[model samples]
Target: MVDLRALFSSNDPVGSAEAFTNRQNQWGLVATAIEDHLRHIADPGFNVEDLETSRNNVVHFHGVGGVGKSTLLRKIEASLTAADQRPTQ
Candidate 1:
């Protein structure tokens, strides 16, 4: 598991981003809820071959500041960007 205490304890945003990126380097479940939500948004059905049939293309995560909201957004951005670049079967 990621030492979230250490991750969010960074002195700056750059350090925080670096720590967030390295979180998956270790074992353990940290933010399954956030991860699962990101995966659900990246579903092929949402961005399938028929753009006209697509429902929603955007998702919003709302909460008070300093509550790991930015962290979740950055993680999801990385996750979805990687997924979009992958070769399909």
Candidate 2:
């Protein structure tokens, strides 16, 4: 379950990370799409044609209000931020 206070609070980054819950499938899809996009850009051997037909460049999340859309975005942002800070190679 999501922790509502942490979801709504901008001051608590750690709390927000902890509050995010139960969207492993969605997160996995997003992560895979991101990886594919990066590969398309970075890998000379990767077929750009395949990416044109096989994957979408955008991940759209649509649902009624108050269903944790904002919270999920926050989680994605935190994850990407952490990944960006990691040492490469």
Candidate 3:
């Protein structure tokens, strides 16, 4: 798993964003994908304890009209489909 403490605990917001985006916690199916990506790094201690964590299932956003929220969601859906990512969020 990725170490997020350094990113959030740091002073730079932009760097934090970069680190966060680069590190995504995917579990169940998404976690499976993560495991696949990290298969090469397989250590005997790969318990993946972080994957056991739960997150809110909701996607929250607030914006003015015609802000492409639907479009953005659709794009996300398409990518998930391509990745065969089942919703466990």
Candidate 4:
């Protein structure tokens, strides 16, 4: 988790912005279950290798609305970006 309070300052807006950008690029926040689930699905052992192979590198998350779907996608995107992996559109 990030301490947004630390981002506020009476001075040094440039410095704060830089720090925030750096933290955004790095995985400074704690891991959430969504990230763990993505990693697990990517791992061949978690789901059968055959099943994953059949899917041809695809995964989907289905849930009711207002259940953090966008948040989950953003977290996954951040994780992939941190790992230098591009998320498919």
lDDT of 1 by residue, 1-89 (tens): 55657645764444444433443522123355546657866887554466566353345565433445567555555655677674342
Cα-based lDDT at residue 86, candidate 2: 42
TM-score versus the correct structure, for each prediction:
0.31, 0.54, 0.30, 0.31
Tens-place lDDT digits, model 4, residues 1-81 = 434454343332333223323333223333454466578687767656455345433455654443344555566686568
Deviating ranges (above 4 Å) for candidate 4: 1-54, 82-89
Best by TM-score: 2
Residue range 1-89, candidate 2, lDDT tens digits: 75766555544444434534588888888899899889777878667666455655788998644555677777777767767674332
Assess candidate 4 and give its TM-score to the true structure. Answer: 0.31
Error of 4 at 60 (Å): 0.7
Kindly report which residue stretches of model 2 are placed more than 4 angstroms away from their true locations once superposed: 1-20, 45-55, 82-89
Error of 1 at 62 (Å): 0.7
User: 76, model 1: CA deviation in Å?
Assistant: 1.1
Each model's total of backbone clashes: 1, 0, 2, 0
lDDT by residue for model 3 (8-76), tens: 465543332233232232224444644565673475755556577553335454444333444444545
